[model samples]
Target: MSISVPQLHAELPTGCSVDRSGFMRRVSGVQAVSPISPPRSPVPLRLSVPGRLLAGGIGLGCLVILMIAGLVVPDSRGVGTHEQLGMPACGFLSRTGIPCGTCGMTTSFSLLVRGDLPAAFRAQPFGAVAGVAAGMTVWAAGYIAITGRPVHRLFRRCSATWLVGILLGAWLISWGWKIFVVVGGLVGG
Candidate 1:
């Protein structure tokens, strides 16, 4: 039996598939037919046209967020930067005399825009992490959109549940850190 040339798919023209006994060998830039081969490193995932469109949209969204951050001035007080956008003060802090979990996030984003990483982290750990995440997403999306390649191992190894759990854990930890900093007088305002 002989291997056939590529066949178009509803998803991608180069979409991968494996037959029983796994005779297919996907090579760099193209798939090929070969004898049974030893195990190799994971192959990068090829993006479908829709996937590329989504990636472009995601990159654009992240860039828009960063641009908005650049427009805002980081508050020296470490919080209340959202007020500059005509938002009211934190009602939780005002009524309960305690900073909310997300307090200082806006200021952190503003500091990130100014390239003051230390100040951004100081303002809000979550916000700093979020800024970095957004930046990375923009980079990854651009790469995927341009090259039609995505880090396959990452997506293959992690499930949706696992990703959600990690995000939840990080959020909780950041919120706790914020509360500690404010209560310990380490944070100003």
Candidate 2:
């Protein structure tokens, strides 16, 4: 719980300065390979009771979603698996004759939970990626809830802009991939 921060005038390493945020930042104009500045030391994650409860709830919610996806039979057409849940057909796809961004996401999740990785990716690459992300979230949340220990705490350095930019880029690229698959008649599309 005790931290010893060097005084601002102290002889620290070149280009590194302890900022007001208590993180060692590179103040010099020397261009680093990555914009993200890692913390001087790994910070420990200790969640409060409310935080643990929230994590448990989120993990359970994701689990239920995955379970429901697994229960549904994946459409051979590579989409419309949600229709099995009494959901209506995709309005966007029905109108344009093009698969929507989330057209095969449900099918992909279903396939993934059913242990058909290849088919899941074929159904929708983004769907598979989302499934993996959700699965990881579930695991991390469960670990946090049960153990109240640090899990990948050092990863908090990346800025919100960077994280959102990466996810958005992936989503757009995956949408383009879906278009390619549909246009090329790769699947039932």
Global lDDT scores for all candidate models: 0.80, 0.82
Q: Give the clash count for each candidate.
A: 0, 0
In model 2, the worst 10-residue window by lDDT is: 1-10
Model 2 global lDDT (CA atoms, 0 to 1): 0.82
TM-score of every prediction relative to native: 0.69, 0.73
Every model's Cα RMSD, please? Answer: 11.4, 10.4
TM-score of 2: 0.73
Model 2 clash number: 0
lDDT of 1 by residue, 36-153 (tens): 8877768655889999999999999999988888998887777788998899999987887667888989889889888989888888888999999899999989988999997555
